[model samples]
Target: MSHSFDPIDNQSNNEHFQEVLDKAFSNPSRRSILRGGLGLASMFALPMLPGCGGTSTASDAAVGAITELKFTTVAKSLADRIWVPAGYTVKILHATGDTLKTGVAAYSNAGTDDAESWANRVGDQHDGTEIFYIGSNGKSKGSYSYAAGDKAVLAVNNESSAEAHFFHPTGQTSGAAVGKKFDQFGQWTLGVRPAAEAIKEILMHGVTLVEVNLDASGKPTGYNATSALNRRITPETPMTVTGPAAELANLKAMMVTKFDPTGNTTRGTLNNCGTGITPWGTLITCEENWATYFTMPAGATVPTDTKLIASRTRYGVQTTATSATAATSRTQGWHTVTDADPTSRFARWNVSASGATAAADFRNEPQTFGYNVEIDPANVNSMPAKRTSMGRFAHEAAVCSIPVVGKPLAFYMGCDSRNEYIYKFVSTKTWDAADIGGGIAAGDKYLNEGKLYAAKFNDTGQGEWLELSINNALIKAAAFGFTSQAEVLVHTRIAADAAGATKMDRPEWGAVNHANGEVYFALTNNNASNRTPGKTDAANPRAYKDNDGIGRDGNPHGHIIRFKETNSMAEATTFAWDIFLFGAEEDAPAVNTNISGLTAANSFSSPDGLWFSKSTGICWIQTDDGAFTDETNCMLVAAVPGTVGDGGAFTVSNTMTVAGAPQTANQNTFVGKVLGESRLRRFLVGPKGAEVTGITETPDGKAIFVGIQHPAEEATAYNDVSKGVWPTNANNGVGGTYGLGGRARSATIIITKDDGGRIGL
Candidate 1:
């Protein structure tokens, strides 16, 4: 989730008559209206601008009133097809395992690719992505090569891999499980007996970068096989911590004495989900759902610190057997791979209470994987660093603003779990336009230090940004026993609870309106089981099950909440907020599953992917859902939204019982509901059992790119060829074969309007 404040001075623009005239005549529909306002003789005689033609002064004046262009549904094909307006076209720019080096073979459509090849090829499961234009000299930010008519280097995040089975020649589970015991050094002397499987797990957990060239028409022409930018960052890659953890006297000493390092550090980034691109052009990949990868051994003693436990649980690390048995344990089973050395980087995947004390064992594994991983994709030699200043949580995505010449840039993010919170970080350093091409140095200047704040939505149509600082009195008085500011920031949820922040539905991708500086967040979904008995509020009113089979209690299918900073500034603590869009079935009752007539085509469940086109000002929404998958796979929609409070108020009911008696007329009301064809439209759909995620656009607005993740994800029986033939056709056609013969692999698709006209016009 990124924070974006509008840079446009709408009020000032409205006062300028000439600028208004330019907008109105840009579209044919508005032009027709302007013509009807004048008689044929006057219409033919009016003065016209270089880009506009008109007849009368009155007709020319009519062109200045258009504020937003109506959104139209572009593509509607059942098969996987790229859709756009008449002037656009789409092409598959690259897919998982596409090689970025000369000696590496091109991606074969068949299933013959191996791990060594894949390590050098594009990584699997491409999720959040950002395009950084390399300039003519191929050295700075603004001079993107694409702008100079050369290959554009994109820093894409291969969030996770589903190629474990394919990575090992005999499969990941081919080794036999054995039991072993270790002596004094807190090491496992004996246990499982698999060597090969252990190596594969270490290689599977990081991000990959690939470089490709786009033709003059904006389609990807080919990849630069030998591009220095091509690199793979895996679990074994050494990374050092640079914040509070690195400065701690005890931690620093331990790092050198025990781990043979000068700073608090760990190896590799795991479970990277959504990402952000810095104004300086670096990739900020977020780690989500990282706790489940590790397992603490049986009959082990856990630490007594609640803060540590909360940190582990917040990220979903198994605290006990209950947490382990409750979910599908680690898929790779790294612990079972080696008996004598279970803590070998492979065995460390398990975050269980083993050995004895923290000093003797790797109990700190839970603390290693939750920060925002910053990598300079252009400089592959640089070690990826974890920016702990950005508080850790189930980070969904990070979006940033276009750094102004001298403004405090802000990053907006969402924690993607039930009842999580929304957060923002305002860089302490002011922006300098000259820093645009400053590379990682600029990132260090703007992103390294910032104040983080969590949102608290109140009933009065307003929200407060509670500071997540060590100096806060409430943080000092914590009953949870957090000792320092760093600990509070690391375990931010507990601090948020103390600050009385409002509990929200699962918050996902967020986008900033380039046109208006408003921030929008998608509250994906939350079940009734999460709501407290008497805690219903206006923003999250439904606490009982509704007709949608979800939201029975808390928010399900979720809604988008938008807020504007006071005076359209990012540094303000006070803001006005309202629900922007609600996910619902078209036929459901107005009270339960309706947001101003949102229908199936445009209505989607669990908003997971969200982005605003820098060029078109269109908001793209994508979903990762189980609640609404019965009708279709996840989808993408294009939206034009008004600021909060644009629409009038409406009342929603909240039923509850007090003293074991039913209380009637518990009505909660809120404003902000304006929906119609002009505001929202279905832009695209995904293949059967896939999620349409990670959307981005070229600077020129000529092309839009999106990721198709896990096509046919539900097909679990790998050996049953007929049940999982998706991606591949019925004729056993493999690799590179489009149209039914090849297995469906996760791919990145580029879309453009066929006419080469300005998009969203």
Candidate 2:
């Protein structure tokens, strides 16, 4: 979905990465630059991203490199269809409204499905996906089995209701007739948000589990509609809230609602963006942008305790103070519906205080979201748990470090908003092989007890993880008032702010190299308001107007960053870092913008998803972009990434117009080895207006399941062809959109080589 949210990135006290580069890299021996891939430097580079194409030259065997990408570069495309290299083929396996039960009518592609029907249908806007099989190989069970009897399930996150335009017949009910389009009336719920319409939209924003069938060759065939384990986790599912927050005072007191008086459980999960496959055979679906679901109605008289006002203001759910934006910014207006029975399920969304006490009303509802939720796929009846110890924010992905026996495990995560902090949760319990299939019990043992730390990238290449715990004096004495470990976990952003964590450009998905322990994250661009001339620092070095014709100035083309833990320890508090790749259009300036030396073949912008194939060890980077859309839709690139500090530290001279004059400034930062076209090239491109995200390959590397989120997401009307017509061949198959005349849907596609060889090799 195109990002639509009022960001709570208003932080002033925290120290942004400052400039102190001269002494940071004083030691000359450690500086190194990769000299393998570059050719003669070109002063004038091309401006288009689709002009270059050829085979990749990346090494077939580096120190842990399992396989190299062997496919030809797929050119930039604007068509409404999936494009891959010459040998691969694409097949749609599952999509929104697809039936997951034994008996159901085919989705009309219209907004006519009954409200109760959504409970058994696949959700919309597919994001992160993980394939889990039942059998055991070693590391956490599941993945890769040619046996005919193996059970496999795919957990796909439905991130948002961005594509809700198609789910309804006449579009959302806005105030005016023009409100038929989602943009015109998306948040005008007070006008008329029918209970039925509101319920359907709410049900489509969580996660979906479907049983995938693999062929005899160990490649995925398709999803089975009637599998027993298939289900939709919507806003109504019962979820147990675990971790210290569930037991402590100030935080525990906030979890009460008429729906769950015990204060130990909550109802459902929403805005599940990215996912983490646990070492104990479970799935951790992260909640992102969940704050927009509730309305803090400007001056509505509600609970007067006022203890949560500070935390609410910091999180953008302002109660005592609300502007015109906050008044009507309720994403779906589910709160406007008048459901009278059973604690008024729809009323939970309107969080203004009204009843006698905190438990009487739903004022504390928003506090329940924004955490990493654990779900055990191996057990169909296991209840989901909100792992509050992981800390709450707009969680993107939770990528776990490679497990070592008797060593504490680390799960690296990024908050998906501009100026947000990245975090790592280290489990107190060491890895024990006995918990491989221990299910939710293993989650209780590890996830419920952990130490959460926020990242602090120093001016030097070295960085440290600032612990967000009561034991930390800084966290304990912060403005949010950390009374206990629970308050620190509940108001984690406030705690990280007090700990002086470094702010990063919208950090999206994170992935750990299976072969090596180095971790990678996608800094998916920043804007003019948050980044300025002198504010730019080493870790986030670029801040300039885009000279490209697209006119996205403020670091619109984002970059990928990687870091290695000290002494390769998962529990290390310090690490070294570098930029693995800088996303840019091929035609951008070569000196600073195109510093990674990308050609037309491998150029991409706004890397939002990062994953390493367990079978091939190939780092897969996916894009969710708006900067370079005129030339191409979002895409996925397969890479063989180099280690940290593979490139030397150098001064980055950026020219930005401050006030009315143009000025240039320099900052020192590190870049990893440049892969050129051969090592890093475009692997796949999605249909029009869609984000290419969430990818996972089979254990044998035969098939890769890629998610195309909300194809034609900007369509105003159901029949609007100018936006796109895809996954349907109604327009006689034109260059891009076939003009299929059908509603667009989010889906997962299976890509495999025609010759039955390993994908990307």
Candidate 3:
């Protein structure tokens, strides 16, 4: 089953060394800095773009094929308000700390908010989101309305939060204080944050399911928290650890906590980032960069067990003794609390194997996380299940296409790390219309028995899916031996290495074109050390200096990559691919940075979040940029993408050297069709220090829901709070120029056409 193309062999020694260094330095708090890096159920049917082919039964006339974007692309802005097309208007449907239940007091927008009420309010750091419609019976009825009529439930992911001010009586304290700062990526300076505050921080890291109904004017309003379906799933929420690895003996060796001695359960999902909605009515929230949350105790021994060492090493799990130069450290220093007495509930943060059995100590606690967790939004009481079959890594998005009549369902995912590979999981079961309303039962059938595949793109503008199964000879080789399918899923990157999967720029959100079954991924920016010229490939073909924010060399402005399966089949092993768009300034050199021919109105960098409208063929691109922020804040852009092979193939230069000579030129790298302002436009620009992420919409295409994450993230001091004030319309210190508000908090905004018409038509 080996292919002639070998991606791993092409990696230079420097590239390999730097990758290891990158992994060694990665931590939870620096997630965006590290690399700048769903269920089914009673199910929301896969939305079909207006002119796309699918099962979506919207009433709007099909445009057949989206040729060009109709509305003028919104220009990039630094204003605090949500910007959109001229006819569109924005509303704050719900924000962080907003009371989900009517009886709870409104959020003070200050650090004085009650910690006990967090369970009844919308969580902080909103990242991923999806809107589900509910029927009178309290079950998911699904929605096709562009204007989302009446009953709807919004599932929001509160990715991560710093305990400092979130739970304190006054915003002054950051709860945990580290006396030593690394001043570098992987150095662990120990600080002390309160255990109670740490607990509250964990409580806010999961998903929030809130009930929503339109206001009198037909605009979305605050959540109905008291509704039976409103629920907050935090890290403390007990969830089943199901899948091939669920019962592995090695898995049990790390669970020292009393909560689940059997190692069959884990307390809460961590770093729940991009999310996906199942057709059968469930929410799949991805766990990204979950490793940094664990702390290596001060005197803990490094793992002697080769299997354990390999597992920890590959997943970037730092141990106590791991140094800045070495590959491990107490990234969060959360384990510092357990230093004196490592037996309390919070001691679970320590992953050292101090006990003989997994239940006796918390060594294996970290293994339970880093998987996609499924929750039934319709049933608040339903237990969430971690679907491990999809493979473990820093999961970004788990996007699924519309289920075809007899074809197996497929889910697309990206691991958000520099030089990481793209992945896909195909169900063993064929699509069954009878399972339309199957709920969790349907999820169990499809997600539990899928074949995980890593992608390998050829220099000839072609790619193939390499299966990551234990049965593969290379995977079972003496060097990379896998004991079971669970191991293959657990150590996916190693399996991908054996499979020769292509290394990409940091892969983030993935969107499947419903109109043609094409898949698009945002390869977020990379630094020069990793993306040096000699290491560039057909997929990651750019290496240039950014002229925008904090200008640096390398592919500072990332690009969008798209591929169409051979014969347009989701399960196809072969495919044709191309660069959909390269993120850059409108004036950047046309040769590399501006490969997509971006114009002023639609130019962007660090393309992070991406989602395609099921009602319109519009592909919404969102950014989380440190590279382009000097010019403007993070923004969202909309585009109507063409299928793969829409553009000509070309060669690019590689000035990087190996021993003493410059590397050869890159070959036959395929770029997407050059798009103009008519097809790509800046749809919205967020406030300062904010990332525009988590995008979803009503089936009718009339409404768009966008998640605003980490607004004013630069405001480190509790007192001054002047770095960036957002989401406040008054007293913003900008003389009311910023319309959103002053005190920054992540929130979700609902966008609708002021004319009551379909959005972006």
Which candidate has the top score in lDDT?
2
Q: Measured by TM-score, how close is model 3 to the native structure?
A: 0.86
Q: Rank the candidates by lDDT, best first.
A: 2, 3, 1
Query: For candidate 3, lDDT tens digit of each residue in 223-268?
Result: 5657877889988788876664343464444433555787667788
Candidate 2 segments exceeding 4 Å error? 4-6, 18-68, 136-140, 144-148, 175-179, 182-186, 245-251, 320-327, 649-651, 667-672, 730-741
Q: What is the clash tally of candidate 3?
A: 34
TM-score of each: 0.80, 0.91, 0.86
Winning model by TM-score: 2
> 1 or 3, which is superior by TM-score?
3
Tens digit per residue, CA lDDT, model 2, 1-761: 55523464547467654232223333333223211111212201211110000011121122243334578999999987778898778888787888999777777776788877888889988999987777644222544222345678899999887667687777776444333544312344344477777778888878999888877766788888988878788888999888853345555566888788667788989888889987777889999888777775555665565447777777766465335454355456666666775858788887887677778888888899999999877677889998999998989999888777788889999998877889999999998857876778888998888789999886566789999988898877776667777778878888999888988888899998655567889998877666565666555567777776776666788888778899878899998776678888888776557777788899999989999775566789999888889889999997876666545444466777777788666544444445657678899888898898888777667788989898887786766867765776443121233212377888888888889978888
What stretches of model 3 exceed 4 Å from their correct place?
1-54, 59-65, 141-150, 162-189, 215-219, 244-257, 322-330, 336-344, 478-480, 649-671, 729-742
